[model samples]
Target chain A: MSEPNTREITYLEAVREALTQEMRRDPSVFLLGEDIGVYGGAFGVTRGMLEEFGPERVRDTPISEAAIAGAATGAALMGMRPVMEIMFMDFITIAMNQLVNQAAKIRFMFGGKASIPMVIRTPAGSGTGAAAQHCQSLEAWFINVPGIKVVAPATPYDAKGLLIAAIRDNNPVLFMEHKLLYRTKGPVPEELYSIPLGQAVVRREGRDATVLAYSVMVPRALEAAEQLSREGIELEVIDLRSLKPLDQATIVASVSKTGRVLIVHEAPRTGGFGGELAAVIAESEAFDYLDAPIRRLAGRDIPIPYNRTLERAAVPQVEDIVAAARALAQEGR
Target chain B: MTEFVPHPILDPAVIPRGSQQLLRELPKERLAWMLQKMCEIRYFEEKAEELYVRGLVHGTMHLSIGQEASSVGSIAALRPDDLIIHHHRGHGHTIAKGADLKRMMAEFLGKECGYCRGRGGSMHIADIPGGNLGATGVVGSGIPTAVGIALALQMRRSPQVLLAFFGDGAVNLGEFHEALNMAAIWKLPVVFICENNQYGMSGPAKVMCAVQPLSVRAIAYNMPGQTVDGNDVLAVYQVTQAAVERARRGEGPAFIENYTYRWRGHSKSDRNVYRTQAEIDEWKQRCPIARFKQLLIEAHVLTPEEVETIDAQAKMAIERAAEEALVCPEPSPENLEAEVYAP
Candidate 1:
């Protein structure tokens, strides 16, 4: 598939197209979850999809996450690649038993005899006023699991490419899409092209402190990196598309050149992806070349509030990353 | 040397002798094969009890001690392409499906040679290549999984049936309700084998279960439900064989409850205080192996001398498996990150 015949679309359209193409390509591919078919998905991401894929492929299931996950696992075992939607990331807790105990362990338990090639596509993050129950960032939860792959794509291009890859991959993948990012637009090729899971893209190149981020924070980090460039302190922003594999090579390369690192993410400071990046940098050969101890700018542990003011305060703003980068640059190791 | 012998014991009230006659009518070789399979399970479980007492196996070990008949009978009916999800007490199901006993025993010991590289111990043994998708420790988790397998089978128009082996306790789990609803609505080819071992942990079937007969719950789902003698291997086999045939013919799922009892505690650490010792002895009197052995003797299929050879063979096979599993190397640390995702 090439970009010549393909047209550019919004992140939402890109995801829809990817799913539609995959469904058409494979008969065994089907969707299952609550309010997805008739309701066109909870966030309307699957709008008009039910008519296209029909009731069989774009299925509307009961409000049971365990049922959805367990069914997906079962289907995968029987040679069907299923794409299951979990409306809210928070609700994944209800189905953790199937995801962790069954989906993750099935293949290994069978000594590689079984493969659960399913994707759990869920909307996450706090920008929307969906509040406490709906807007928590739980990527860290899936990242902790061994058998499943955790992926959160920031751009429309990556969203389409990564999802296609996830469906084709012969393992369970937890695909987390930020709630606020669905409408965001980018140049996604009409032709199919899959982005590998564990690779990182250099969103912006600079020589000062390296800023490693993922998901919604990647765009924000790149924006901050541009603003900080005019202040004479250039920053390198690395977008970590896949969290579990953690694309250590790109982060290590960027940090080695700059000698100072500042990791930014929307997840809370305690035990977040930033901690994982920091640990990797500290343990690697890049540790000896650091000009300053790696600093992390992440969200506070407080619950995301409904109020605009409180919600903004709960997550990492562009100013937070810029400030963290400046402070790290000033304090040399 | 200790002489190996098969002792015939009986209580037809638990398992009727007529079912054994049906088994004999089936291919004689097939009947012999089924009996050998059940014997292997009995020997393995007995060894597990011994190892559990010695503290070699960590975590609670759920024994399929008395319910071997139902496990072997149901699995024997499935084809190579058909899928099965076993319950926590799943050793019999795994072994019946052709899981290598040495590797399986290693899994119980949490050694690297275990199927999951020691990640999942005794409660979650799996070998999906042989159509054994694996078992879950969580009650009723496999119900939806089996439903999903059937759904896929239906989508592919493949004549493959999915089987889920659960205990009577699973009927109480909410997932069971959701799974049954899905299976009924789609009319998927799934066989729900409920080994009604009379108790969930220490709670008796009569006290904990609100429903009189657990199989009756299937009727509400618009599926056929039946109750069979779980202690009688042949009886379980006959009913389940019919159910499997129905599923393969696309007649939809069937709920079959096999009434049976476990001869030991729920797990090794269970203090036998919840039930009286007399109750335990009563169920022990209806042991599946004893009843089946008596049928073989009465029918002249196996003589006292021939049965003695079978017992010796079973013990030797189990002992060999134990030795091989004991010496097998643990999974290398590098392999820990290997199977998480396909490369």
Candidate 2:
């Protein structure tokens, strides 16, 4: 239950509130991105922040993603908590060296003498008809690299708290925000609160089967679980909040009790994060309790198409999760 | 335009100076210290080569044996607290910024007592407390990194300046232009120094770059640019000192191209197939340390005896550092991932 004064706000607003509160509380917190200052960010998450913080704090940089990312790494070394925004997660491919090689490895390369207190906030996943170049969920790309924290918040509340935690985190963090979730409203407190990184929240509890989801997939899993409960087939929907330093224990417990699991995401399934999750579960003690072959419900191994119907078919819909979970629950009994 | 002057310092006019004003104004001890640091880098690099040849050191090393004067002279202009973030070929820059010879050597030897606890080897030595922010082996990566640190300092309203060092080939990198524009537009306190070592690895920078005297790229970014004879310690000192003051005063960033050469190959794996032997011998005749030693003796800044004593002390210092580093314990395997994330 949210406390009093906890008004319903969109995921975008929660992110802005977290940033606004942090900047007011600390002098070092600042924002940087293309057209972020005057244009108020591509998604309007930082709208009106420019007027409040002034030009020095809310900087609009050139369209060079490499420079923007590298500059964030540098500023973080000197004790500035920089929150840099990339226009789209797809464009982050151009800035991979800076993010993966430099920002992620700078601390360990310097033997931990350096603290990169920075965040790379970008809009990830697809549904806006932005097509292939603009729509992609690139969290798996970042999770592969060590020394950087990765967060994908499903609810407005988690978005605010997790972003605050990322900003306060002394290491580099990649904050992946789904484009479609910006308008999704949920109860969020007006006061500032931070959620610790690497903690998973079980959105729904059931014993029939386990559904592992994150970011935009969590809400879909919940809808699917609600449908499955009508047929007396209940699913425990878990939101894996932090991708790196993953909350493996929570996943193991749910899998051990349920005896079946379904990992879901919107990214292509060929080399997706679901593979990593499956390996983690298979290697853990949860493997002994599994009653069925593990199943994965993820995006097709193709780019997110421009057509609305094809796009919907590319990733898992609520019905897809319901069907996948239903199949897992009935098998190996 | 008629001919590409590979070593521009051989020409008197190409030095780009009215006079040796800094050499005249600097105290006797400061001048001696500059020369002393240059020698120390020379001896240290030579000892590193000796260790590499004897199989004590693994991995390739980018030895800055010929560019010591460029490093020593420019770093001498900054205060102890000022910062520096540099590129791959960074041994001279690290030592000139006051790296403990023993700790640096231990790092080279992959010992636990090393600066990075044996995590980062030769190309990534960092002395954080001494203002050496660290170096990356990635080409041209330090450009925006230096600007970032400078931006942080600017936001804090601090007067500390940063010196960014890269090679001649870094001029062609997109990060160079992007970072320069950011530093210029933000008016960041950064002094960009490009050690034009004539070649980047085996690729001739002349063929790689469309621009001669890469500092001219600074014009596009609206920053002041100058090229100096990197071998002339006094000339490099004069140029960097002015740029450091301009940055400290918040006048914005400056681009300085120090025309020098690397006596050794790019790294230990270099086959020496790109450049001619005669060209290498000719540049060796223009050795920065030897030239600086002659200048100091002729300028009466130090007697011949004093210069020899400094050289002898440097050699002995390197000897002592290697001796200490040879016996240091290796980093334990259990603690490999302990430093991946900060506490």
Give per-residue CA lDDT, model 1, range A1-333, as digits (tens).
345766667788888888998988888888998899989998888888899988888988888888888889889877789999999999999888888988887877666667889999999898887778888888887788788898999999999999999999888999989877888888878777799889999988888789888889998888888888889888888988988667888888889998999988888889887788899999998898898888989889877889988999999988888888878877853
Clashing pairs in 2: none
For candidate 1, write residues B29-49 as lDDT tens digits: 666667777888999988888
- Best model per DockQ: 2
Candidate 1's displacement at residue B110, Å, is: 5.5
CA lDDT, every prediction? 0.84, 0.90
Show where candidate 1 strays beyond 4 Å.
Answer: A1-3, A326-333, B1-25, B51-60, B100-103, B106-121, B296-312, B323-335
Q: Pick out the ten consecutive residues of candidate 1 chain B with the lowest summed lDDT.
A: B4-13
Tens-digit lDDT string for candidate 2 (A25-116): 99999998899998999999999999999998999999888888888989999999999999999999877878888888888887778889
Q: Poorest 10 consecutive residues of model 2 chain A by lDDT?
A: A93-102
Q: Look at candidate 1 and tell me the lDDT of residue A139.
A: 82
Q: In candidate 1, how many Å is residue A233 off?
A: 3.8
**Best candidate (score: lDDT):** 2
